[model samples]
Target: METLETTKLDLTGKIDVVENISREDFLEFYMKPQKPVIIKHLYGKDAQVYKWTFDYFQKELGELEVGVFDDESETRQDDRSYKKAPMTMKFGEYLQIIQEKPTSKRLFLFNVFKHKKELLNHFKFPNIADNVLSFLPFAFFGGQGAETRIHRDMDNSCVFLTEIAGYKRVVLFDPKYSKLLYQYPYSTHTSIDVNHPDFDKYPGLAHVQGIDCTIGPGDTIFMPSGWWHHIEYNTAGLGFAIRSLSPHYKDRVVGILQVGLKTHIDDLANKILGSKWFDWKKNKTIERANRAIQKLQKK
Candidate 1:
């Protein structure tokens, strides 16, 4: 019998981990090349890692309401359903429900800015990321069995997401596999549900390779631009992400436009036109890809 772990094949090999590496080495090997790597010691000799706990957050921002999505990600038909009308709860209230008593309804209720600022003091600027990191960090938190759908991030930027609390399993696919994964017509999210992928419905995913990495407290994983990924919360934990501009200036400019403007416009278009628009785009995408393959084959 096949389990969730064995459902997909992992062929990218293990990601490299470097400890006490120089800035120049990082730039040459990982940053400039835009390959993923795990830096074992992002914080050098700092005892402050112990201070980033749920208890500390509760004490810091008492009674503050944060935006969260309580809906189960797996149950929702579309990824944006939760975002269409967000559910919110107080920070303290969320922490209680998230850890001791978690539900199928996923909760993403962190005070985005407030929590980010407080946690910023924990780590020094990394040479691997350098000044390329954009401001206002992103965080995701949930209990055991919680997960994110298989998808690329909205922005075409490099991401360094660090685990602060419990274990998280990040299953990654190179951007090249997007065609095989059956991506959403107008969104960055893929059509395949990581927890329960319907292989019959998504025949394109056959033989596609994935890479899995599990991170614990104080561990960070670097994800390059457009890398397709799915995240599973193995236990109740808090994770922080810092997205940096792509090394290429053109890529950075494009990312800024897409994240800041294109997403809203696309979402609005999707809403107005509905299923017809989506169906046409999906068919056209497959046709275009097939034509490209045929051209390459004849060459």
Candidate 2:
């Protein structure tokens, strides 16, 4: 296997860690400011972390059918997080696959509790944020070494992601640096590989600053709305995220447009133009990134 080059960028900014925080303080300090924070005690004492192991899931919800996503792209060279899942399998089989060996298979944006409502009894939702999308609680599962490429959620909502099992390394960038990250046209993600960034090809990445964090079981990380994140599963793990609306109304409007307008437009264009549309977006990403670099130089 080819060794990954050491990352050229330095993420000097720190992701705050707190043992505990009040709902009001979390709002004023972290949420309002759009800062990322890892809360160690957010889940409350009664939360059942031990019961969330892979064996338990496999035993209880094993027969549930699920869409499994992987790091493969058919239309382009870039493997994207938002790519449509290519296959489906029994939830138990996938869990067994990951448990036995490292694999690229990932279970993305699934609500397992929807199939078995009794699963919700394992944990209590934190009351730190308002308008918690209780009905939309989603779960993400990944095997060792599986990576979710750099991307932002299209819904543009604040995400409180709780690590249920194993460990995950996360790299985050504020949305303000979207152009520097070479965000593709009409997409919520960048094709740039954060693990071993090609500085020569994507020079704008060297100028970008970000936060790096690793979370273990029971830790909840607050991801601000529209933040770009790259996630790597250090070990096969499961994470649950409860999303809430962005505090700002304008951001909510953008989220609506992203899902209701931008997604459909991209799909239509891709279907009509095929590979030509991808080529255009790839070239446009470079052009826009160069402009962003030039603007930074002028300042």
Candidate 3:
């Protein structure tokens, strides 16, 4: 971001792309080693692949009261929807807003299989994971230029995300870069926006290594567990994600406590102490990140 030479920077423009990769190769090269890879031509000639358009989504979820990410209310109005107090709207109405133009809100239909099991007939999931979580079949809809915050799944689950429509670019950093990411204590997300980070404030990130991948419809990305990722929807992108646990389960259990229980505690603290709880946590995180950067420079 500071106009440094590309060679000197830790991020590279390339990602491992394979077409119709064998299961053996996936396990040996990417899965076992915990590296990210993109598989091209993974599927074809499927009704779901072609039929999962914006129009189709509207019809299927139309009458349902769906949860929406209210960007302004999340910060300005101090409204916390869907941790317990969710903001609900008609799916058809939200579709209209996104179709018109880009908007602050995002449409996140989590675990659709729970509500409408009939919708599963439209698509097929790949047989890759040893174990896939049942309730985490995520469907995300974002407006043009919308970005998800840089975060790790507190469950420590590996991910296989496929593009259903439009295009998206993902920026990923390995778990080792967590200290450089300005992550709050016991939280799953980083505060700095990866696409347009304030380098002066988060200088440790300058030395962070990351992978950038642009995937279109039908392409799937294998995101290793604990990786930090920020996704940008280049167009009005619709995507689905399936998450799996590592063969080793002990660490993931620890992650659930750190992120799941800790996050609930933080929210409860905020409810009692107000903004001071968040302000103090954010300030402490910044202090830690700044110190790490200074230490890196000294070395």
Candidate 4:
């Protein structure tokens, strides 16, 4: 087994403001800086539905038809109703639920905001009108074990992830860490095991500085666009996220380039070089980076 070494993040004394701020102020300070902020009070605080706990979420949302993946069959089944709903289970029970056979056929929630108006209203940010709130809300139901390979959001859109129930663990890296992440062809991340990384292969990762945060119910994390993040559920968690493109013209242009030029490059690389090519390029990049670092150290 590969031993993993991680630098612990100290968010102690970090600012926590729950007050409502104007749209202009939020965009200028918090959103631009990509700083994480938590607001305890919500807009529909008085709504009965908004008061529903994690247990209630499973009871109501879990019964509905959801999307499921069957790993053995390598197929996706849509709008499948769950039989044994495990919403009230503890963290341990949730882990067991994911480990069930077939590894697929796991019913996962989708577009939850359309079903839960009250919960969606609670996330309403300023300057975003009811009809004009241009985003979707989706939730993953199951253990925190499912891995969403490390990747940055498309178009460098800043993202806000608000947790409603349970806990989520996030590992975030700044834009400068992009090269070290060894983004895959036609995708945004490498196949590196983030928990137990291969330092001998990707030594450049040692120079990357990152911020880690574990969020709980009612906590919101603001991640800037283009910032690479890897998220895992520490427990069965329910949450929705909102993403917005940068308002600046220069940022928007770069975002377009990523989607167009970068994406095209990746597609071509995958077609010509095949899957193994990515691994080969990643190794070469790491080797070059190590040599550069050694030279700098001697200087």
Instruction: State the lDDT of candidate 4 residue by residue for 176-212, as single tens digits.
Output: 6566555543345555556776666666566566666
* Per-residue lDDT of model 2, residues 153-198, tens digit only: 9889999888889899999999999988988877887878787788
Better of 1 and 4 by TM-score: 1
Report the Cα lDDT for candidate 4: 0.56
Which residue ranges in model 4 land beyond 4 Å of their true spot? Answer: 1-25, 42-65, 69-109, 114-123, 128-133, 268-273, 279-299
Candidate 3 vs 4: which has more lDDT: 3
Better of 3 and 4 by TM-score: 3
Q: Is candidate 1 or candidate 2 better by lDDT?
A: 2
Residue 136 lDDT (model 4): 64
Residue pairs in candidate 1 whose N, alpha carbon or C atoms collide under 3 angstroms: none
Top-TM-score candidate index: 2
Residue 178, candidate 3: Cα error in Å is 0.8
lDDT of each candidate versus the true structure = 0.68, 0.83, 0.73, 0.56
**Candidate 3, residues 117-220: lDDT per residue as tens digits?**
77667666556557767455888887776666677777788888888888888988888778777777656666676656666666766768788779998788
Quote the lDDT for 17 in model 3. Answer: 89
Q: What's the best-to-worst order under TM-score?
A: 2, 3, 1, 4
